[model samples]
Target: FQFCSTRHELGSIILTTNLDFDKWPDVFGDARMTEALIDRLTHRADIHVMNGESYRFRQTLELRKRVAKEN
Candidate 1:
């Protein structure tokens, strides 16, 4: 209810989600919540699925090399 009602009233949102639509119900809890939420957002949203090796891990190695250069 909260998820659906707010977006309907406000008309826009920014959400960062790691799961695809098939997995939405797991987070939202049930079909009704998932259904209603998807209904509202689907019409106006742009889904961006980001895929690749994690930048967090890549950056850690890069940072280590930079620190070694400094030493």
Candidate 2:
């Protein structure tokens, strides 16, 4: 958190998580800290809210079916 907040100008950080901002405190273990982190992270970010099953999850099921058929 300190690293990202202090040195954000150094580069970019990409984070992928299923949790939303309201639920971030569970991961950070501090509501205030999580709010601060969200503030800094979203200051100049292009956020994308993705829905539906993840591509990798869907692909894994397909791969398993293909292997079963081969067996």
Candidate 2: count the clashes: 0
TM-score of 2: 0.82
| Superposition error at 45 for model 1 (Å) | 1.2
User: Can you give the TM-score per candidate against the true fold?
Assistant: 0.66, 0.82
Steric clash pairs (candidate 1): none
Provide the lowest-lDDT 10-residue window in model 2: 4-13
| Alpha carbon lDDT of each predicted model | 0.81, 0.88
Task: Summarize candidate 2's per-residue lDDT along 1-71 as a digit string, tens digits.
Answer: 89879867677889888888899898889998888889888888889999999899999999999999999
Show the lowest summed lDDT stretch of 10 residues, model 1.
3-12
